[model samples]
Target: MDESYFVGWGTLMLINAVLAQGKNRSGLNWFLLSLLLGPVATFFLALSEKK
Candidate 1:
C-alpha cells in the first residue's frame, strides 16, 4: 500500500473524531463507525443527530 493511503485514512479518522465530538456521540461509537464506514459514516451520523 502507498504511504499516502495511510495518511489520507488517518486524516479522515481525525475528521471523524471531530464530527463525533460535534454530534455529542461517544468516542467508542465514533471509533467503531470509523472502522466500519470510514469518513462517509461521519457525515451520516452527523445528519442523524436529531433523529
Candidate 2:
C-alpha cells in the first residue's frame, strides 16, 4: 500500500521533470520541488510562462 504511493509520487516527479524541460525550466529543480509540493508543483508549472 505505502509502496504504491511512493511509486506514484516518483512517477509524478519524472513526469514533472519532463514537463519542466519542455517549459525550459530546470528539471532537477522542479523534480525536487515536486517531491515537496507534489501536485501543486504541476499546477504552478502549468501557470508558469514558457520560454
Candidate 3:
C-alpha cells in the first residue's frame, strides 16, 4: 500500500518482460504474468531457451 511497493513491482515486471524477450517469449504476456507470479515468472523466463 506504499509507493515503493508499486515501484518495485513495476520494476520487476519490466525486468521480466526484458528477460522474456531475450528468451524469444512474448513481452506483453510475460509482463502480465509477472504482475501475478512476480519472481516465479522471472525464474521460468530465465530458464527458457532462445528460439
TM-score of each: 0.70, 0.93, 0.89
Q: lDDT of candidate 1 vs native?
A: 0.73
Tens digit per residue, CA lDDT, model 2, 1-51 = 689999999999999999999999999999999999999999999899998
lDDT of 3 by residue, 1-51 (tens): 899999999999999998888888899999999999998988888887897
Reference-based lDDT, each prediction:
0.73, 0.96, 0.92
- Candidate 1 vs 2: which has more TM-score: 2
lDDT of 3: 0.92
- Model 2: lowest-lDDT 10 consecutive positions: 1-10
TM-score-sorted candidate list, best first: 2, 3, 1
Task: Give the per-residue lDDT digits (tens) of candidate 1, residues 1-51.
Answer: 999987887777778777777777666677677776787777777686631
Candidate 3 TM-score, C-alpha based: 0.89
Residue 45 in model 2: shift from native, Å? 0.3
Sorting all predicted structures by lDDT, with the top scorer first, yields 2, 3, 1
Q: What is the overall TM-score of model 2 with all chains considered together?
A: 0.93
- What stretches of model 2 exceed 4 Å from their correct place? none
Best of the candidates, TM-score? 2
